[model samples]
Target: MFFSFVLCCLCLSVYADTDAVKSVSVMEGDSVSLESNIPEIHQNYIIKWTFGHPENRIAQINKEAGIFETYNDVLDGRFRDRLKLDHQTGSLTITNTTGTDSGDYQITIIGGKKITYRFSVTVYAPLPVPIIIRDSSHCSSSSLSSSSSSSCSLLCSAVNVGHVTLSWYKGNSLLSSISVSDLSISLSLPLEVEHQDKNTYSCVINNPIRNQTTHLDFSQLCQPCAIRGCDSAEAVIRLVVTVLVGSAAAAAVAVLVYDIRIRKAELETIQTSHRPCTHCS
Candidate 1:
């Protein structure tokens, strides 16, 4: 009978805990308000707002005294100068929240009936700018034209992003994407694609807070092919020029040789005619 009674009490405590807790999320360096639904405070009421545990009191209001207190010495470093209380509503506001401030909070009201309000807070830092890198370390500008296909691997990465999505886009089309709901972490996604002519791509990192994007131009990546085409055109032009120059030189040499032979023949005939005339006289 005693064991059964203890089990019932434990179950009731768990149920109450689940019912009292409310979830709240805020970004780092931002402010959040933990609401307490105490619309009216009696003259003899006492309101205490605590962080994490009831022992670590942050703020409290004594309706009888008509004054409020902000705890500094007990809180140590947290909520030192950024704590505010709305005396009318018993709401607690925290400014410049940090990751360490994420936890459970409680408000205990001592009035006609003792009532408590619980809050579960989460603080996240904004995601950093994502980076994109080519995965093929062996591929260089000089080797791009030598490869039969311009396809290569790429990686997009981001750090300290919580519950965020990372995606790769080929122009307006979504190619690949990854997401994590776990704690803030560094993550990366890989994609392989052919570096076709003048193709455009972009990488995007986004969450509920903010988004960042980086763009890629395929024309720049496949520049080696254009360079190779230019080199081939230059070789063809040089070959044609060499053939024309050699043909022109050969024709000039043939014309000069023919003229020299004709002159020599004419001179020989004149000499023979003059010698024969002398003999006859």
Candidate 2:
């Protein structure tokens, strides 16, 4: 009995290996197909497909009865008008896939032999092209690291992205990267390069299936020209302050001269009065 039990366990393990679950991935708004992996289907065979739970039957086919149907009204009609079944291989296809469409799917076939297949589907939204912008937070003139202004600080951002990696590449080399698995989250990465870097650089956002990239324009976002705006703003403020100071000084000088003239006139009148006027004499 023990020998028989061991043999049964081995057989089950072999079957499990043969029926291992498959993973499928597709971009949102795209179509994806699932294969039954069955070479041929004989007459009187029945094939059934389900999603999430086995009770949620999505598609089915009965060869003997000549019946092929899809449950478009099931599961809140999430699969309405989006399910397709292959008459030959019993494969299933879903059109205009979305992130909500990702889940576990099962297939059961009954003929001379019973067979099962499981699938895990994932649908990712198209990746947003990473945006590279100058990062002045740590690159201002007051920054100790920016005193010489030898390098430029930059940031790469991807907004509303899910299941992706954001990376900075320098001349086909990865400088830095960060990965995210949450749904529709914003992420950013930082990079620093020489102000006059001649090597090419790119920011890329990618998921398992697709990627989007944006090239860096050295003169457009780097140092030297990058901080000119900040510097120009400071220069304008200084110019205004200098003009105001000059005007105030000029006004003060005018007031002093007027006071001196008034005092001199008063003194002259006093001296004339004290001298005993010629008319009085």
lDDT of all predictions = 0.75, 0.82
> Per-residue alpha-carbon lDDT of model 2 for 51-115, expressed as tens digits?
99646899999988988899988888999999999888788999999888999998887764567
* Per-candidate total of colliding backbone pairs: 0, 0
Q: What is the lDDT of candidate 2?
A: 0.82
Residue-wise C-alpha lDDT for candidate 1, range 48-144, written one tens digit per residue: 9888765588899997898688887765667788888887777899999998888999888765456677888988777777887766442544555
TM-score of 1: 0.62
Candidate 1 pairs with clashing backbones: none
TM-score of each: 0.62, 0.75
